[model samples]
Structures are given as C-alpha cells and as structure tokens.
Target: MAVTQVKVDATEARLAAIPAPDKGAAWIEAARDAARARLREMGLPGRRDEYWKFTRPDSLTAPEAPAAALFEMGEPQVFDGFDRVKLVFVDGVFDADSSDDPALAGVEIERLATAAQTDIHWARETYGILEARGQTPVPRPLAALNTACAGDGVLIRATARAEKPISLIYRHESKTSDAYLHHVIRVESGAELTLLENGPAAARFNKVMEVDIADGGRFNHVRAQGRDHERRAATHIFARLGAEAVFKSFTMTVNGQMTRNECVVEMAGDDAVAHVAGAAMGDGDFHDDDTVFVTHDAERCESRQVFKKVLRGGAVGVFQGKILVKAGAQKTDGYQISQSLLLDGDSQFLAKPELEIYADDVVCSHGSTTGAIDADTLYYLRSRGLPKAEATDLLVLSFLAEAVEEIEDDALRNEVTARLGAWLARRRG
Candidate 1:
C-alpha cells in the first residue's frame, strides 16, 4: 500500500522527536527493523481514515507531546489492597526501587530490556508478530511505530496457573514525557494468568500489548486509566486464542484530555472464547475512544464486546467495534453493544458498530445507542427522598453496572465500582 504524503510527514516528524534505542538481540533487532519498514509503508493515521473520522488523531500523532500538569491525587490508588507483584514505571522508565521483586511472582518474569539482550528468548517468537497480523484490513500505524521504537516493557510466560495477579503501575512525572511501551504475554496450555494495569502513564503515552494463548490456556486482564485531566494517550492490544482457550479483558477510564484504546482478537481454535468490555467517564474537555475488532476463524467460537461511556459538560466519547466470522467458522456466536449516557445536552457520543459473516450457521448481532439520562428513572429516584444529584449518581452507577460486571474477580469489581462512585460523588460535591 502506498503511504499518503500527510501521513508520511506525520510519521517522519514523530520519529524525529524520538531517539533510537539500543538494538538488543539479533531477533529483537530484526523485529524492530521489520516494524520500521511496516511503519514507512502504513504511515500515520489521519482523520480521513474510515476508523478515525469521528476522532482526531492530531495529538496522538504529533511530533511532540503537549505539556500536562501533574494531578494532585486526593484518594489512594485503586487496587491498593490487592496482593500482587507490582511493577512501577515513572515517565516510561522502569523503577526498581519502588517495585516488588519479580522473583516473588510464580510466572517467569523478565524485563523486555533484559530479555532482548539474550541471543534467544521465548519472546522472540511472538514480539510484534500479532501486532503485524492486526495491521491488515486496518492500518494501526501508531502500534507499528511502538513496536519499532519502544525502549522498555515486560515479557511474561505463564507455564502454570499464577496464584496472584501481575500489576503494572504507570506514573506520569514529567510535563512532556513521551513514552512507548510494548509487552508480550504467553500462556502455555492449561495455564492461567491475570494482569492488572492502572495509572496515567505520561503526558503522551503509546502502548501495545500482544498476547498468545495456547490451547486450553486462559488469560484475564483488567485496566484503569485516569485521574490525569490533561494527558493524551493511544493504546492497543492484539491477542490470538487457541483451541478452548479463554481471554477476558475489561477497562475503566476517566478524566483524560484525550485517549484512544483499541483491542484486536483472533480466535483460531474451536470453542475458543473471548470477551472485551470497558466503561469510560469523561467531563469537561475530556474525550475517550474505544475501538475493538474480533475475528472468529474456527468452529463454535464465542466472542462478546460491550462498551459504555458517560459524558458531561461538553465531553466527547467514541466507540468503534466490529465482529467478523470467517468461512467454515460455523456455529460462531458473536455479540457486540456500544452505548453512551450523556449527562447533559452539551456532551456528545459517536459510535460505529459492525458485523461481517461468511459462515452460514453463525449468529451475530451488534447495536449502538446514545442518549441522556432516563427521565422516568431519575424522577422515581428523586421522589424517593434522594437529592437530585444523588439520584442521578445512582442511575449513572446502575447504567455502568454491566460493563463493571465483566470483571470476574469480586474484589476488583468492587474496587472499580467504589472508585467510580467516589469520583461521581466528589464531582457532585
């Protein structure tokens, strides 16, 4: 494919601002070279792109990160009480002094920088491999750029069920930090792994996470991005699922200047299951976007995508989701829904939901909606002696319940609910 002149210039300008990192092992260097070549061919995403029409990519593709003021956190971080191996990153650099020992985690945990130094490693087979696959049918130039230039991240392989979750904590310390991170996770057959992520990574953050789940393997993930009002970010997740494998991921977002989150999944084995869900709340000048694509290539596969957003005070939200069932992918069951709750008329929500099927026996459905808070429900709550604001907050939580329910862990679910509830309450106060 020929790259557009505007995109070429945009891509070039971004690279010019970023310094090249140490090329690690032979395989790592080869992967980075391939990614750079891919970026040149694809260029950067423009508003003209079909998928980017509703949301501008200017800040995400800019040559330099916009300055962001630090947030004065008033509450303890989410998931603070959970027991897990915590890895900390400040301005995209790993912080060993604040992080827990990786040895304490059951899975094989190695920093990407460390693993890339070795001549051979388990990550060599999968790094940037899935992201490359995800590019076709849709060009994700930012992800390709990340693969080519990311300086550090983590590589994890789970050979057995991990007793506790692995948490990645990102802290934005600099006003102009531009950070790129790439992560690879492999779940061996019959093994299980859970990942938890939170925090505002940087003034401008770009991240890519690639996951490969073997037959009968299971991978669970939950993420929270928020509390930084002026930050801008773009993130992507590419996953491949094997026979009977299970993959579930959910995210909660709030209070960012602008953010775009994308997830791409391919189910290649029979009876594989994949679910992706998220909830985003934005106020004032905030904007959040969720883009997801899931493909069913094997028989009897099941996939679901559910996303909801709450917007107020002229905030904007966008959702783009698609489900594709290939030929011979009979009995494929896919469902998708994207909806938005507007707290006031000034807020806006844009959605595009799609389903493509080449199989005769597959069942697929998708729907999208945008609307203000329910008047009848609000009136009922207010009549019950609750203040108008309190009643409205209750309905907002109720509206977000489904997406929050996607989190399988009771504690995690409760924490998300409480955190969001607190945000709503504080805003009302």
Candidate 2:
C-alpha cells in the first residue's frame, strides 16, 4: 500500500516518543517489531480516513496527552460488591503496591511486563496476533501503536471456572498523563471466566485486549468508563472463538472529552456465539464513538452488535458497525442495532451500518435510528406527579435498556444501570 507523507511524519513523531532500545525477551521483541512495521506502513489516523471522518484525531494523535482536570472519586465505586481480584493502574502505570496478588481466582495471571521477560510463555501466541489481523479491511493505527509500545497490562489464562471475577481498575492522577496498555486472555477448553473493568486511566489512554477462546469455553466482559468528564481514550478488543465457544462483552461509557471503542471478532468454529454491546452518555464537550466488526467464518455461528447513546449539551456520538458472513457459513444469524437518543437539537449523531454476506442461507439484519424522547411518555410520567427532570432521567434509562440487557449477569447488569442512572441524575438540570 502506498503511504502519504503526512501519515508518515505523524507515525514517526508518535514512534519517537517510545524508547528505541529493545527491552523484552526474544518473542516479545519480535512481536513489537512486527507491530512497529505495521504502524509505520499504516501511519497515524487522520480526519480524512474513512473510519475516522466523524471524530477528530488531533487530540488523540498529538505527541503528548492533553491536559484534563481530575474529577473527584467520592461516590461509591462500581463493582465493589463483587468478590473479585483487583488489578490497579494509576496514570497508565501498574500500581503493585495498591493491587492484590494476581495468583488467586482460578486463573494464572501475570503482568505483561513480567511475563514478557520470560523466554518462553503462552502470551507469545496472542500478544499482538489478533490486533495485527484486525488491521485489514480497516486500518487501526492506534491499536498497532499500543501493540508496539504498551507499557503495562496483564496476561490471563483461565483453566477452570473462576470462583470470582477479575477486575481492572484505572485511576487518573496527573493533569497530562499519556498511557498505553495491552492485555491478552486465553480461555482453555470448557472453561468460564468473567472480566470486569472500570475507571478512567489517564488524560489520554490507548488500550488493546486480545481474547482467544477454545472449544466450549465462555468469556464475559463488562466495563464502565466514566466520572472523568474531561478525558481522551482509544481502546480496542480483538477476539477469536472456537467451536461451541461463547464470547460476550458490554461497556458503559459515562464521561469523556473524546473516546473511541472498537471491537473486532472472528468466529472460526461452528456453533460459536459472539455478542458485543455498549451504552454511552455524553454531555458538554464530549465526543464518543463505537466501531465494531464481526465475521462469521464457520457454519451455525451467531453474532450481535447492539449500541445505545444518550447525547446532550452539544455532545457528539458516532457508531460504525459491520457484519460479514462467509460463503460457506451456513445457518449464520447476525443482528445489529445502533440507536441514539438526542436530548437537544444542539447534539448530533452519525452512524454507518453495513452488512456484507457471501452465504445464501443466512439471517442478517441491521438498523440505526436517531430520535428524541417520547413526548407522550414524558407527559404521562409528569401527570403522575413525577418531576420533569426525574421523568427525563427515567426515559433516558429506558432508552438505553436494550444495550444494558446485553449483559448476561443479573447483578452486573443492575450495577451498570445504577451507575448510568447516577450519571444522568447528576447532569440533570
């Protein structure tokens, strides 16, 4: 592929920030080199790029993280009720002193920094493999940058059903901190595990997670990104599923100056299931984007893409989703929906929904809608003696119900709802 001069310069500028020395084991060093080459070839994203035309990449691609005021964390933390092992990161750096020992929870877990030092490790198979594959059809330069220069992360191997979930908590302390993190998760055959994430990591954050699920394995992920009203983040999740495996993930984004969340999945085994969903609420100076791609490469596979957004106070929201069914993938079931509830005329929503199919016997559908709250419902609630602000908050929750329902666990689902409600309440006039 021919490269542009502007892209080349930007890629080099970002690459220069990372140290030039090789500091990891042979495998990790090789992986990072490969990712560097890919990044060089693709270059940093620009507004002219097809996938990034809606949101500006200037703040995210700048040499340093833009300054952002820290929000107070006085409220109750999300997922505090779950009996899970916690891994903490402050300003994108791992906080070993404040984190729990990673040896618990029916899983073998290790930090990427430590695991990469070993000459032989299972992480070599996945560290940057999936992210590299996801680049095609669409170039994700930020993800490649993460693969090449991730400072800290985790490697989790689930051998059996975990008795407790594993939670990753991120905290922002500096006014201008930039962070990059990459995580790899492998669920062995017939195993089950739950992964939970919350908090805003830094002024600017770039993260990537690669998941590989073996036959009959199940992986569930629930994340909350919020409370920090002024922040920037670009995150990616790349997943591969084996026969009879299940992969489900949902993210709720509460606050950010700008955020882009991308998920790419490939179902290579028959009867595999993959579902990715998210709910985001944006206020003043906020811009959020959710981009997803799912490919069905085997027979009898199922996939879903559900996303909801609530925008107010001149906020902007964007969604780009696509599902592709391979030629021989018979009995494929693909569903996609992206909806936005615009609270005022000042806010905006942009969506690009697509479906490409090579199979004749597949069930695939996609729909996108942008609208305001139901006036009739609001009137009914107000007539029942509910305050106008409270009624609107109730309606906003109802609008986001579909995406939240994608969370399979009842307790976790309710916790997300409560967090979202609190955000709406705080923003209500």
Candidate 3:
C-alpha cells in the first residue's frame, strides 16, 4: 500500500511554480488556480487508497507542456437517431459547424463558456463545481492536471419534463497531440433528459464530467469512449442526486491503448435511485478499466451496478466497485456485480468488489468473477459441429449481451455491438 513519494513530491513542486490567474477569464483562471493550489495538498494514490488500489496511477506521468485551448476542429460524423440536439468539440475546443439542436420549445442547451459570462444562476451553480467536492490523495495526477487546464464544455438545462433526448459529441482529431476536457451537466427538477458523449483518438485525452440532478429529476447518460491504438484516455463521471431523483448511466469502452472509466454516484437526498451498467472489450495491447463507487447517504435510496469485460491477446482489464451506506441511511439497497472473460493465456483481469456499511438497517452485496471461456459449454457447441473460433465468438456475444441490453436505445446498442465485433476480429487475426 505504499506510495511513490518521489513522484508525488515532484508533481507538487511543479504545480507550485504556475503563476496566478489573470483578471480576464476570471472563472476559468480561478478554476486553474484552484487546481494548482490543490495539487500540493493531494498526492498520487497509494496501495492503501482503497478506491484506486486496483487501477494504478503511478504509470501516468504528466506530459511536459500545459494543455492548449486552441486547436483545429474537424468535421464530425453525426448520429442518425440523435435528432434532439448535438454539440461537438474537436481537440478540446467547441466546433460550431458540427453542433445542432432542434429549435424545440421548452428546452435550453448552451455552451459552458458563454453561460459563464451571461447566465449568473447557471454559472454559479455548475461552473467549476466539481472541485468543490474536493479530492482524495490518489497518486494519479490526471484528476488534478485536468482541473488545472480544461476547456469549456457543453451545458444542457432541460426544463421540467423534457420531451426529447440531448446528445453531445467531442472529437479529438489531433492524432499526434494531447488534450484535456471538462464538462458540467445540470438537470432541473421534474425534468427528463438523455445524453450521449463520444470521443475520438488522440495521443492523450483526459476528461472529467460532473452532473447534478435536482429533486424529482431524471437523467440518463450514455457514454462511448473509443480512441486509436496508440492513444491514452481516462474519464471520471460524478453524479449527485437529490430527493426522488433518478440517474441511469450506460458506458461502452472499446479500442484504446490504455483507458479507464471511473464513475461515482452519490444519493445525497432521500428516496433517490441510481442504475448503472457498463461494458468494455479489449484486444491487442489495449487496457480497459471500469470502476464504480456508489454511496448511499440518505434514507430509502436504491442502486444497482453491473459491469462486463472481454479481453483478448495481451490485453488487460480491471474493475473495482464499492458501495457505502452512511450511519443514518436506513432502508438503503445497493447491489454490484463484475464479470470478465479472458480469451487467451496472455489476457488478464483484476476485479475487486467491496461494501462499507455504517447503518444497521441496510442491504448491500457485491460479487466478482474472472475466468476463461467455459470449456464445457464450448465443447457442447463444438460437438454440434460449430467451429472453435465461431463458437467462442458466439459465447462472447452471449456473455456481453446483458450489459448491451441495458442500452435502452436499440440503434445505439447495435452500433456498439458492431464495434465490439470489430475489436474481437482484430484480436482473433
């Protein structure tokens, strides 16, 4: 559980040299300054950092140059069923040419930078709000580095009971460069909103997303992160729920040199509910990590988490999930499950499921399983005259079907399934 103090000390010293924020762009400057100040206070996570024990952060060393704000944006491929609205970011900058929102009634979707300048209420409530939650002493510098330099993100505020879904896409065309992005989402009370966020390949791209839901609101988020073979990416999503608020999240990860998706959901208000499902497919030298931390801080909250991973070649997969119930969180119900399939001897998987309970009246359970293809089942299928490879592929699809089914949008689910097939084929070859 010991940490590398040398790296932590070096990172803190580097952050201390950054100059203060300029008077102009005060909010962004403030955010960056806050990040630097917090850097000295935070260190890389150690083995003792229970939340990050599985996914080691010491491997990620900060790049030399600071993240840039100006970069060329390329034409983005639009989704067919996403007629509600679209906002695109390329190389961490908002691209106007690729954004579209149906001029519908009773809805408002805008950019975070513009909102910061004009809308006081919106800016005050959500702008750079993720930092207020504070940071733990995780050895990973991406979180702090992301806070230090992040571009504006798309903001959506659907009024009470939204009628349509909202979609946002961020593309990284900088095949040889690195980028960082930050996004904040706020859903008002009694409203219903669906969102899709996509990312392209880059040498490196780190993203942090914070979503806040008011009482009686419903937010359904679907995230897809697919980058090039040599690219590295990490995403952190934190959601805070209010009384009677409902949050459903579905994540699909495929094709990355090294990618990790970390989700933290807090039921801070009574009667809140959260449902989360995620799927990751890794091939070649790719590494995909999906971790979840759900906390029940109020009474009568319910949550369910399901994660599935498929690995091939020398690929590696990791899943760490935990559910915690506070002292007064009576009647809390939380469940978590993680499953993985290693197709070859070179493939590997690490899974950890933990539960921390302080309240006497709560229900929580977690389970994890990591194993190779079931030989008995495979033999049965091969005995029926199916080829070995074909039988394995079929079994893989069947194993991953549960997580894919969680995607309520069938079209999107099919698209992700196609991507999964492509990744598997490459590994087989």
Candidate 4:
C-alpha cells in the first residue's frame, strides 16, 4: 500500500535529523532500515490529517525538546510495598546501577543494546515486527519513528509462569531531554507475565512497545504516567494474540501538558481475548488523548475498550477507538466505550468511537458520552452533610470507578484509586 503524501515541513526535517540506533545484529539493523524507510514515506502527521485534527502535533514533532522543570515529588512511590523486579531508566538511558538484576527465574531479560550485540537472539524476529504489522489499516508514523530511532529499551521473554511482576521506573532530571524507548515482550505458550511501568521519563518522550502472546499465554500490563504537568509524551502499544491467549492492559495518567497513548491489538488465533482500558485526569491547560484499535481475525475472539477522562479548568481530553471484525471472524464479540466528566464550563472532551464488522455472526457495539456531574447525585451528596467540594469529589470518583475497575489486579487498582483521590484532594485544595 502506498503511504499518503504529506507536505515536508519542519516536523519532517526534525524527524530526519534524528539518528537511528545502529545495533550490531543484522536483523535488528534491517528492521531499523525498514522502519526508517516507512517513516520517510509517511512523514510526520500534519494538522491536515484527519487522525490529528483534534490535537495539534506541533509540540510532539518539534525539532527541539520542550523545556520542562523537574517535579519535586513529595509522596511515596506508588508501588512501594509491591514485591517486584524493578528496572530503572534515568533520562531515557537504562541505569544499571539503580536497577535490579535483569535475570529472573522464569523470564529472560536483556537490554536492547546488549541483545543487539549478539549475532542471533530471540528478539531478532519479534522486535518491531508487530509495529510493522500494525501500520497497514492505519499509518502510525510516530511509532515507526520510535522503532527506527529509539535509543534504549528492553527485550523480555517469559518461558514459564513468572512468579513476580517486572516493573519499569523512569526518572527525569534533564530540562531538555528527548527520550525514545522501545520494548519487546514475548510470552511463550502457556507462560504468564505481568508488567508494570511508572514515571515521567523526560521533557519530551516517545515510546513504543510490542508484545506477542503465544497460544494459551497470558499477559497483563499496568502503567501510571507520572504527575508531571510540564511533560509531553507519545506512546504506542502493538500486540498480537495467539489461540486462547489473554492480554489485558490498563493506564492511569494525570497532569501532563500533553499525552497521546495509542494501542493496537490483533487477535490472530481462535478464542483469544484482549482488553484495554485507561483512566485519565487533567486540569488547567492539560491535554490527554487515547487512541485504540482492536482487530478480530479469528473465530470466537473477544475484545473490549473502556476509557474515561476527567477534565477541569480548561483541560481537554480526546478519545478515538475502533473495533474491526474481519471476514470469516465468526462469533466475534467486541465492545467499546469512551466517556468524560467535565468539571467546569471551560473544560472540553472530544470522542470518536467506531466499529466495522464483515462477519454476519459478530456482535459489536460502541458508545461515547461527555457531560458534567449529575445534578441529582451531587445534590444528594451535599444534603448528606458533606461539603460541596467533598461531594463533588465523590461524584467524580463515582464517574471514574468503572474504568478503574477494569484493572484485574486488586492491589494495582487500589494504588490507582489512591492516586486519583490524592489528585482530587490537591485540586480541591
């Protein structure tokens, strides 16, 4: 398929200036070459592009990284009590001194740079492969750019049921850092893995993650985009599921100046299940976007997308989600919902939900809604001897409960909820 031609403006030049990582492995180099070629043909998304109409791409595609002040954190770490293996990244570079041992019992972990030095590795075939596959129906030039130029990331393979989750923690100290990270995860047949990510990586961050779940494999991901109001990020996730495999991911974001999270999933085997959900809260010049695409190509596959955003004080939230059931994908079940809660008249929410089905035996549904807190509910809460601000907070939490509930892990859900509560408290104060 031919890539749609767009004008080569400053953004295109900026992308061209970025150097691609030169891995020693032949296959890795080949993948980067292919990605660079595709990116050149596609170019950066312009304001004219329909997909970028809601949010301007200028800030994300600029030649120089935006200046962002480092946030002085006062609260304890979100996953402080959790038992997990932690990998740390400082200013987008893997910090071996601060990270735990990469080697886990049932999982093999290698830094992308280290793995690339070997002539042959398991990641040779999977790295950037899924991202390349996802470009067909929709062109994700930013993701392709990350695949081509990302400086650091990880390659993880789960060979058996992992006893503990793997956590990625990012820390930012540079005021003008531009960080690009790419991760590859492969879950062997019957294996299970849980992955966790937290932090604001840098001033301007571009990230891509590709996951492959083998037959009967299970993968779970939970992430919290840190509360850095000056940060800007564009992240993408590409996943493929095999027969009876299960994939679930949930994200919680707060207070970034701009953030775009894109997820693409393909069910390539019968009876696979995939779910993606996010809960975001933005206030005062903040912008958040969630774009998701799920494709069903096998019989009896199921997929769900649930996203909710809370906007206040001139903040903006956008959601674009789609579910596609291909021909011969019989008995496919798909559902999608995107909702937003606006606290004031100045805040705005924009949503586009779609479903395309070629199979006659498929069941698909999509819905989008944006509104203020229910007057009746708020009145009831206020009448119960609660202050107006407290009552409003209650209603806001109620509105976000559905999406937060989508997190399958109880501990992670609680942590997310606590963080939301804290944010609400701060806003009210």
Per-residue lDDT of 315-356 in model 2, one digit per residue for the tens?
A: 999999999898999999999999999999999999999999
> How many residue pairs clash per model?
0, 0, 5, 0
Clash pairs detected, candidate 3: 44-138, 44-139, 45-138, 45-139, 161-191
* CA RMSD of each candidate after superposition: 1.1, 1.2, 4.0, 1.5
Q: Candidate 1 lDDT, tens digit per residue, 240-307?
A: 99999999999999889889999999999999999999988989989999999999999999999989
Model 4 Cα lDDT, one tens digit per residue, 52-141: 888888888888877899977665877767989999988888899999988788899988878877889998878889999998788888
Please write out the lDDT profile of model 3 over residues 120-230, one tens digit for every residue: 446456554554452432233456666676656666676766666666676656543655666777788888888877766345677777788999998888877763455
TM per candidate: 0.98, 0.98, 0.86, 0.97
- Give per-residue lDDT, candidate 3, residue 331: 98
Ranking by TM-score: 1, 2, 4, 3
As a TM-score, model 4 comes out at: 0.97
lDDT of 4 at 293: 93
Model 2: residues >4 Å from true position, as ranges? Answer: 19-22
Instruction: Rank by lDDT, highest first.
Output: 2, 1, 4, 3
Candidate 3 local lDDT, residue 169: 72
Model 4 has how many clashing residue pairs?
Answer: 0
Alpha-carbon shift of residue 189 in model 4 (angstroms): 0.8
Q: Show model 3 residue runs off by greater than 4 Å.
A: 1-5, 12-28, 44-52, 64-81, 101-104, 119-121, 134-141, 383-385, 425-429
- How does residue 185 of candidate 1 score in lDDT? 97
**Candidate scoring better on lDDT of 2 and 3:** 2
